[model samples]
Target: MATSVAKCFLLSRCSGIIRSVTLQGKLPPVCIRNRNLLSQCPSFSYGNRASDNPQDGHVNIPVDRLTVSYSRSSGPGGQHVNKVSTKAEVRFHVYTADWIPEDVRQKIILYNKNRINKAGELLVTSEQSRSQQRNMGDCIQKISDIIAKATEKPHEPSAEDIALRASRLEKRNKERLKQKKLHSAVKQTRRVYFD
Candidate 1:
């Protein structure tokens, strides 16, 4: 009877029908699923997408440095809101990212100190739309805007600009003095003079 049972178990195992089988103190344990199978899968590639390309945007920050996550958005969407996780959150480690220039990184760090966390990661979130893809795009765009504004250089005053500013200042000063002289003349006339 034991021989027939063992034969049946072996046949089921070989045919991939039984996922796991435990015999009473006689046979070894058998597991059909291998946990290490996922390790053999190919790595993700961020290339080819327009959003991933740094050259297409105003800021040249690479997409690979960003870590994106999703959670359920908090708003009035009823049952659909409860089911779908559409909110997108993007995290970028400014100190560790190698693509950004040192000056730009410093500027970003200084300007966006409020957004940076204890881990030195800039966290940006978006839940404006019901779609996850739109939220992700909004998150990325927000980060790009922050970096762009931080790295922007102030417009230097040219020779013409300096001259124009000087002329305007002189004109204002002259007008102010002329107004003062007219007020003084009025005051002199109103003065109580005894001859």
Candidate 2:
């Protein structure tokens, strides 16, 4: 029975069919259609191991290290907005999160100094949606974007790039010198001999 269920899941995933699958009693029924949506479910089977693949350039935040909370959102949701908490705020300590790469953690801290509190937890909030689940997804996406941007390395100038820059600088200096000489010549003509 277990093998047959596993085969069914693999078939659905390959065929791009959205099916709600629950594993044992651990994970909730999650829509398993694509790899993109897999990250949204914190309890997904590959959620923790997804970050191990460095080739994808994505750093998946594990649920164990995250702190998520919801609060009442101030927006135009009529009576529903006042009664329910839809604003999602996701936070994780930058220094203490062992799942994040050490160098990337420092970069996240440097890039988001304003967002990180004194306790070193980076906070991201989203109140765009009336549904708490949507708001939480948005918050997670924002954090993922910040981490992705932080992971980018500075561009190293190649020999061709350096040569092109040098040529441009030389041309600019020559033009400036020519302009200065022209101005000096104009001022020289403006002078009159006292004799």
Candidate 3:
């Protein structure tokens, strides 16, 4: 279970892959909030936020904080693409979620500036799947995940951890230099007598 969360943390950075997870069928223990149950969870940027209110009105967002902007989503929609706004854009305001304090909002805005449009709205859209409901649900799930990330308390590596990382990197650098020197000598031996 802890390994799963670690995998999730590592995979979160990959582009265009939105992972939809349903917590309903499973027991409460598998919930996303419970992902940090490990004794010494490796310091990470996410999965550490304490809490959040899914409600947007309580915060502040256009069209009820979670406005579904319906644009005719391109690709595979075929004729339906021209007719319907099947693509639902789920908007979430970072400053509003109960878990995101003012300071954290600043960080979230900086971290996800690309996702947010010219306006203050953060857009998470679903067009990967065709079903309107599926797209919408997927969009909402992504929005929730983004909100979860926005509320996180940033992780700062401890001095000891930093030193350990530095030492490991130094060792790797020395090994690489030694291998390169040995390779150059092997190349020198292969030189033709015509040289």
Q: Give residue 95's error in model 3 in angstroms.
A: 5.2
Candidate No. with top lDDT: 2
Estimate, for each residue in 1-195, the C-alpha lDDT of model 3 and write its tens digit: 323432333233221132223322111111133333333232212232222233221221222334555567888757878887666566656556444456557766887889888767677887865555556556645654554565456599999999999999999999999999999999999988974
The TM-score, computed over Cα atoms with residue i paired to residue i, of candidate 1 is 0.59
Worst 10 residues of 1 by lDDT: 19-28
lDDT of 1 at 87: 83
Q: What is the TM-score of each candidate against the true structure?
A: 0.59, 0.71, 0.49
Overall lDDT per candidate, in order of appearance: 0.60, 0.62, 0.51
Clashes of each: 0, 0, 0
Give candidate 3 misplaced runs (Cα > 4 Å).
1-63, 92-99, 155-160, 169-195
What stretches of model 1 exceed 4 Å from their correct place?
Answer: 1-65, 186-190, 193-195
Residue pairs clashing, model 3: none
> Which residue runs of candidate 2 sit more than 4 Å off their true CA positions?
1-60
Q: What is the C-alpha RMSD of each candidate to the true structure, in Å?
A: 18.1, 9.2, 14.2
Between candidates 1 and 2, the one scoring higher on lDDT is 2
lDDT of 1 at 77: 97
